[model samples]
Target: MTPQSIQKTWWKEAVVYQIYPASFLDSNGDGLGDIPGIISKVPYIKSLGVDAIWLSPIFASPQKDMGYDVADYRSIHAPYGTVADVQTLIDRLHANNIRILMDLVVNHTSDQHAWFKESRSSKSSPKRDWYIWRDPKYDALGNRKEPNNWKSIFGGSAWAFDEGTGQYYLALFLPSQPDLNWESAAMRQATHDDMRFWLDRGVDGFRIDSMNLMSKHPDLPDGKIVNPDEPYQSGAEFFASGPKMHDYIREIRTEVLDHYDVMTVGELGFTKDEQSVSEYVAKDRHELNMLFTGDIVDMDFGPNGKYERDDFHPRKIRTITNLWQNAMPKFDGWNTIYLDNHDSGRSLSRYASDAPEHRATAAKMLATYLMTLSGTPFMLAGQEIGMANLGKDYGADSYIDVEGRNYYNEVLETRGGDVGKMDDVLRELQLKSRDHGRLPMQWDNSPNAGFTVASAKPWMTINKDYTEWNVASQLDDPESIMAYWKQMLSLRKEHSDIFVYGSYTALEESVTGRWF
Candidate 1:
């Protein structure tokens, strides 16, 4: 289909690339990546044919969840850079015609944020309702009990007890990360003001983090337990895609997004079989331009979730793509295509072959799948180089990702500290944990993977195979993964008709053994 025949929106035809700032490059040799390092790479980014770069939160943060815990939204994190540096980086990228997408993490805010600080100061404080504060439930023995059965995604009760105010605050992720009460009109206006803050500064777009998690059940009730053995019924059952989500989206759109020409994509945090994703991005809905669905990524997880899973099968992935594609043609909302990101393990290891012999080929195959899809394809940094998962030998001490360490500890505690059981969990993590994608980029064979000075220790450990997989080694090789990615991009640009708008048809195939 020609541009005139199909949807002609810039976002629909554009490709997005996500950059995990801390691991991309360390300019000051502080062992943490900074804005200047990213500024230095603008030319390389432009070369990838990606129209926009989706930057993971670079806001002032405590680094508890690797910048997800924002202490201040308007200011840049000191480790990353000063606010001036961000403006310069934006100018440089814009100068090169590359757009920027900021990660909007409005589901929660760092407890250190001024709003939360005042909210927790006293029950009668002016900002007390900014963050969710519920009276604690007391047990028969007078012990303080949680208000609800909601569990944090980071492996504990979602409600954090605050003895100072004698109330529990809701934090779906971590104690330091408090969930914002969207039910409060004040909070809604505050979030809208924040979006305008960045828009005024000229960001091309925003990938709304935990988008489905904003609206929550008013009374705070216990969700139906899917598995009696687990701690809580996946808090998503009660809050995600809640009753008032569409209202909130439309409100935000009418207030901020509609005024600007920027692209808006929401992250659907939970799984819903219905056409829920379509509702978020349908043009008539006046909400989002597009949304991300993870059902495709979850196809590899077994009955026990990512824990008891063995491997990813291409056939299953194909089925997931077909399901999403065919499910929403009527709703007419676009899809956000991706296989890996800062949260998942490397695609080469999880979805493709990581074996030395077939790494590049499998990488190309996965790229083929991502590129041919009729959606806005997003590529995580380092994927173009066929970066595989970090080695399985890494232990708990080597883990830098907050979520990974927490999950590892959770698995160990559930097994009663059994070393063998811990090994299984660690092994599974090596194959599929979020940490796998957190390793520093392998720019060259040099120490620190050229991510930092030789003496500087990266925030996360460097992959052992950096020498063989670095970008310096693969750039010009015809059979290299980077070359394949470039070729795939070229193919899409050359024939947008087939790759961008062609009706998807999954080819039937069967494989009994491992693919070579």
Candidate 2:
């Protein structure tokens, strides 16, 4: 079909369901979810009427950032099955007429990855420049200091000391997830080659993880301090949307994505402006078809990186909606609309009136608000079951996220190790934390939430009320959240004018409530 006769970008009207493979389903007796397990759920995914499925990182990894820190891009992790299992999934999804979008995590790789291992072995190695490395600053007292004033997302310095080279390397996330040096031509070519491998395997598209953060300013200037009362500052400006980001993205598009009938959507973390969104996703740019913006998600956090208990007002929500609606015209590109993801808490608890009595109604309302907007709707696993955030009793030790653990320790340290105060802080953080959404999917009320075998202990705890709020139970109930989501997806697919290419207008914005 011609570009104009395409009606709209396939992704524009599509409802994309995101599956965190590790917690999705476990076909093996082992506690982890795998590709074969995901294959078994194809009919259920198809039943939702969604056009595509976006699986989170399933590549070989140490599970440091769940699966974002890739150790091998060409193969699947052993726990999640092999590359052949992925092919089976692709074939089955194609048979069901559903597309697949694999995660592309080019920003960093696990320190255990061969490239990083070689880069760190010696400063003179050929791969030395593959990852960012620099000399540490020394105080007059001769104490070693970090290369910059940047703070890691996991709560400490972004730089990690390398004993072998007596230098520091940048890691915006966990220490194991070393940032890649986009300045290295060899690194870019390698990443491009990896993308081609997936495309050749019939994968429909890619969801670029931390895509905007692939590059950093060459000067590496220290950004303005974020919190004077606190020790470290947020150095997001120093690395986000870096100097050669557009050029690097264009290269990837031209070399890999543009060669196939693929759709690319980037996850933009540090962007708040519309111009950048337009430049990255505009038609014919060969960069991306859309991007996931975090302005809505940032509202839950205070300026000091703490949870904002009293800041969630209707006016704030309206302002966010208006900014995106007015910034980019409907036809320019698409947006990925979501209230929850693998890295955020469940929407039912964080956004809805979490009281059990009101959860379903509020969940549907939130769904209607987002699904009708002019963009592709993305639903995280178990969101259709109206899943709430894990309760307070779910301690920090139970989660695998490095950032969650760091924040828990920071709270204890700040409180002079007061367990009670630390507990309260941890509870609040968990209420808004990412680990809540990473829990095992609620398939049935059976043991292990029907996600794995009876004797298996899942990688994380299954939701306590999974028996009442689960796919099997809700699928037969017409008024259930799952049914509502199915209806919404069906409507979106049938009514392309309003849900696909329609212009967005904020109807209300004030202290009482916000409407769009």
Candidate 3:
């Protein structure tokens, strides 16, 4: 298809910036980021030349898994500020001509959510079927056991035995985040209502979190053991692209999304097959407008998943990028382009060098790759200033992400709690932990990296090199990564037809260590 023949939409011709609120900036001297902090940076965000911002979850929560575990879908967390603050933020961004996409985490809710509370009140409660609950299995000697051997993406058993309800509830992530039952009409409607609430309040769209994991296998059978050393098995096969997955998404589109002129990007969890992804994003599918691919990020995953190391290879990324670039447009589907986000290590450290002498060049090179891609590019916060990963030398106490903490505990248990035996694991975590990306944004070289007042401690550690790599130092430099990103974004907007909708043709098939 020619570029002129492609469907034209605002999102297709735009770039998105993702903001992880907690680490973005602190407005009050409370050591935590608030909506007002984001409000204060409207001019800074506008200067980037991006079209929209994808704000991470800020709904009321117990914060067990940060704000992803929602206790009140319509309310904002107190640390982040009130609902009134979000309205002001929306108005400010819109006034700057920048759209906002809220993170929609409907696959699960905090165990503290009212629905979950009632669901756990009793086995016969009216809302008992609102969540995934199964009777406990018993051994030959009548020993009580979890319903299945499913392992969580965060680590450990996926099922948590609820003594009050006498059933095991599914929590694919943390125990505090119980998976919602999409089959329940009332529950699905409630989610749709929440979406409408945000849309009514002026949200331009949503980045649906874990969109593909909404439906689980009806039978809820035991998962196959994939790793010998791990106690639980991977249940992704039975849950990821389940029988009713597309049906549920289509229903959502028909019920809520179709009514609004909004952009929807679903986080396609554990799905890599071309056909599976196309079904979710193809124009005629009536589902998500686009989908984020998981293959490129998981390319370096070794036998033990993301924990074990595999030497980085550019050829793998080249193959995956080429496949998607050439394949997605064939089905009238689209992709969301990005290298790293709050969940992964910084791209400069993981994909290129973050060394003192090479960091700026590498960041510009990465920015060029993203801008020239045939999709809507999404830039992570602080990526343009050449932010990097915390190296292997940092101690274990610096790691605070749930996934990283769980891995640390697992390694300690396997190695008999020997601190000496934790060296290799610590090194791996240093390179791979999400905490590296969650560090406070380096606004300036001041104490606390200018993320908060010097007297107030930031929620997470500031990157030690923030003094050298920060926005204040690089914004005006003509050769800086931030400056280059600004130029590239303008270039992309100038020739959106070619850069965003143009066909891709690889010049070399056997290339090594270089992305064409």
Candidate 4:
């Protein structure tokens, strides 16, 4: 079908590669990926024909949530290198004509952050209002209780008790990552200053982490109990799209983002509905240029959440994709097309067959879907080579992600120490854990998959299939998945007006699994 002509912008037509720093490569053989390692792979990234790179957080963090818990937004994480290293990286990538997007995690800060430190000090401290704090409620017997029945995304209570201040502070993800109080004008200003610190250093834009989570319910009310076995409840309804979400988003747009010509893709962490998503990225809204929606990724989630899986229906893919592709363009809101990233399991293993005979074919189909789609496409590092999830045989002990570990312990406790139940959860973890995506990138069939020196132990395990799946073997093979991806990218660029600006129409709107 002929594509309707639309306004052209570099961001709208770009193919972005997301790099999870710790897993990409190790420069000093210190078993961790650093800026120098990324710099070393510049030519390889360029070879992919991508126009931009979205780097996951490199900010100073305590490593509690794998760099999501920012300890100092202005400083670089020590293991990843220093501010000077980041500057050099920006220069190198820009010299190659590739724009860079830094991860912005402002929904919360590491409990160890200087601002959080002051906020937790004395109750009368000037920065006390910088974080969400509420006095404890008491029962008839005078026992203190949490402020609300909110469950953390990682499991357990969302509110963490602080002994120093005799109050509880909100930590929606992990206890070490305390939610920042966006209600405070001073806190908002500080966030803007931190953003400028990076934009001034030449970052092209930001991949805002949990951007929708910036504004939370003002009342801090109790959530309805969804699981009788667990005391806390899902707090998404109240916190996802708070009353002031759009107001705060527009404030950032005018005060910070609008000042620079940069790409802004907000992560709608909890806001999944089409209406809520359109409000943040609609051209008329004066907000973000695009957003990363979780609808496609979360389609298989069961009532019990990510760890519990529902039957995978092929129809959901068609329905979900069509819904976004058909609706967003009407409102002038753009979409981010991706199947997997630093969080979910690999696309090949989750959405397509990963068996030896069909892996290659499934991967090519995924690439075709991503490139031929109606919006910007994001390719995760190592995805080009068909990285599959570490199989269930790796065992529970191999899981390193904090969220998976928390869920493991929570499930164990709730089931009264049923080892079998824990084992079942482990099976699910093998398929859903973020750690699978964090496995070291497979560069070649060498010690440590050429990710680091032979003697240095990697921060995470290299996938066992690396010997056969590394890039060197496929780089020269014309029929390889990586090669096919390169072809698709070239085709997309050659027909930019059709692929990027094209209006989408589902050819199989009523197609179901039975039809296959």
Candidate 5:
């Protein structure tokens, strides 16, 4: 449908369901979820009454950052079926009147990606400047040091030495996922072209991954050390939402996104202020239609360091609610509010009261609070069933995430070699770790949680509580969190004025227990 023909701003009233492709379902007996597997589950997604399904990256990748490290923007990974399967899945979703928003990991690409491969081959290659490349800073002893004190989000130095050129390259996450230099005109065009390819294929929208990290400082400088208490400080100000980022986003909006009837939501990190949030998604800004903020997600992480623990309780809920309320009046922008995503642990176990007797009430309460808030609400896969974190004993090798495994070993070897302490760290890590959200979807209480037929062990173990939390059991229960979510979504569809375009005013402060 043309943008003009559409009577309402669909995004303003939309409910986006986020599916981590690897764990959602496994078809073709591969023990890994694929396009065909997702296609088979379209009916179940449609039953949730969501406006769109945002599939976390299914694109061809080295799987270093799982699917975030896109190897080929146009094709599906071998493990996740072919491009034809994606097209079929899109067709099926559209047939059910549901839109599909594919993940756009534009901030970076897998180091194995053709562009990165070519970029790394030589300093004079055509794509040499496609990614951030810097000369190593030599120490007093002539030993090569990282260009700056910038640290990777996954711990350790951000710069990786390239033996081919004898220079260092920047990787914000896994060394496998190298940061793209958006300053280059060719890089910008190539990224835009990638989006056009998907838009032309009839996909509806995009969830732009690490969208705010696209632009960086022109003259890379050594940023200030933020924390003396911690080992390394993230030089985010120099890299995140950098100079000319607004221009870059506006260019994409005009050239590619605005030309089509597509909803765009950016994934923003370390951005907690109203002004920065407003500029990205405000109506007149003409950048993204909405974006996910990290204030709520950051609650689980201890302010001191990754190893430290924090009590995440209902009182922390106010911090999230207040930020949204304050932000709503300042911008005509919409929010993509979610408690769980592929990066965080299960919300049921982390935020909600996970005790068996309390699980249902807390799950419903959390859903009610999130769904009623103004903006688009995104429900992570298996969130509707009150899925909790996996067992603490699930070993590091079972984890598909590179960062999780690295941290596991680092803590074990460095910190007194205490296995019990390691267990505590793992428990906390499980609370904040991305792998917890990447487990196989609990479809039924059958072998393999009904996710795959491979008989071979799934990459990550399915949540053991699957027996009671499976979709099959919850679908029939009137008081189930799944059923509550269906009702909440129906309310959103039925009463667009109150739930959609309505101004959000938190009533919890004035009247306790009521969040109107």
Candidate 6:
């Protein structure tokens, strides 16, 4: 590692535990977890030995994309709690010596938001420029067409036409969640104000969501069709890690972030340019502290996309880690290490088998990589307990995720709409569903897995293996996955240099085939 790159910071040393509040704990018996639930579990969070907590989007939203769609940036969602409740949660978390990292979702806002509603009202609305609304293209005979060939991340045209405004607005996720125009000075200032809102209220930092796609090309251009078999080509090149991404990040840092003693980790979907990624996290650059990259996690994508079949390549994990760690300019850029997140599937089930023969050992191996890596480590809520998938039958009744539903329906369409006959489709979800990580956090072996009241319905299904894989049971067993995670966390504090700054050296393949 380069001498100048040996920079030290509290964030660089933190062991971040990501909490999807809705699945963590339910204190009010609302069938959904809330801020108080998190507050009540601060002791539990601290017990895990993590220094900081990163909460997913809790802002006032319609829950269209499970809180990624924000209606009001300043207010807490009613389902979670009130603004006062958030203040108390922050204070209590601080009292426990744990830092709070709020999810900063500036890429898009809910369609119900005042700005979007106003923008949709008329073509000449003052807030019109706040979103990306463009006129349609014309063919030889002037028949109306979409502005560009760009496709949404959620499997549709990126453009959504509004009859009232006579133009199509861009929404990369859902029609209800319209993409915000980062180019607008007013929009950028408003975003800055929102960041200041939480910073003033004592949020330690932010986990910027969809950070790469915030800035898109000005002309709304078409993307190259990489795969002809796929319905919609990925337009990420036009938006993700865009030309102005670094420029905008610098401006945000100078005008907003530099004023506060805070750290930021951008949710940058896998980028090809190592030089570009380093610029975002370099210590000397006025940009993000670290960033979430999915290259290793998404390595299994087959001919099509997420749902396509591809055998898991274990050795590729080391390849990705070595690339990023060495790719950092002078090793000055920091990387965020994690095997699972709200969007990614569970690590125990994804990277390792949950079978009786390999369950605990597999968890240990993954945790070894997660904690021993030379970067900040992050743990998903139920990962420490060795939580497995809920099951394979992701029929409409059991499925709770929006992206999964989109992929499921698309796959079903290709099979004549008879989903019950498609065993392969169901198996794919069993192995790769993001909901595997979103299952209710197993606190105990209660009927509701101690997540909510037995009678109340959880927002999603709970893993049936909670009987064997839960906090209470694991806490008592020294050999349990949870206990192993705690021990590793303690060790991380002792040998912070090796875990936080040491350069990684990939070992050669062993004849015994023990590790990849």
TM-scores of the candidates are: 0.96, 0.95, 0.98, 0.97, 0.94, 0.96
Give the C-alpha lDDT of model 5. Answer: 0.82
In model 6, how many backbone clashes occur? 0
Show the colliding residue pairs in model 6. none
Candidate 4 backbone overlaps, count: 0
Model 3, 401-505: lDDT tens digits are 999999899889888988899887787787778887788899999998889999998998888998899999988899888999999999999988789888999
Q: Model 4, poorest ten-residue lDDT window?
A: 507-516
Worst-scoring 10-residue span by lDDT in model 5: 1-10
State the C-alpha lDDT per candidate: 0.84, 0.83, 0.89, 0.89, 0.82, 0.84
- The candidate with the higher lDDT, 5 or 6, is 6
Error of 3 at 496 (Å): 0.6
Q: Which stretches of candidate 2 lie over 4 Å from their true place?
A: 1-7, 228-231, 306-310, 393-400, 508-516
Q: What is the lDDT of candidate 3?
A: 0.89
- The worst-scoring run of ten residues by lDDT in candidate 6 lies at 390-399
Q: Please give, for residues 411-432, the per-residue lDDT of candidate 6 as tens digits.
A: 7898898967677767777777
Query: What is the C-alpha lDDT profile of model 4 across 1-516, one tens digit per residue?
Result: 334535678998899999999999999989999999999999999999999999999999989999999999989999999999999999999999999999999999999999999999899989999999999999999999999999999888899999987999999999999999999999999999999999999999999999888888899888887778678999888888788889888998899988898999988886678887878888999989998887777766777689886756778888888899998877888889999888888878877888889999999999999999988899899889988888756977788898888888888888998777677688678778899778899999999999999999999878888999989999999999999999999999999777888878787544453644
Error of 3 at 154 (Å): 1.5
What TM-score quantifies how close candidate 3 is to the native fold? 0.98
Clashes of each: 1, 0, 0, 0, 0, 0
The candidate with the higher lDDT, 1 or 3, is 3
Give candidate 5 misplaced runs (Cα > 4 Å): 1-7, 227-232, 392-400, 508-516
lDDT head-to-head 2 vs 6, winner: 6
Candidate 3 ranges beyond 4 A from true positions: 509-516
Global CA lDDT computed for model 2? 0.83
Question: Any residue pairs clashing in model 2, and if so which?
Answer: none
Q: Report the C-alpha lDDT of model 1 over 233-259, residue by residue, as the tens digit.
A: 666767888899899989998988888
Better of 4 and 5 by lDDT: 4
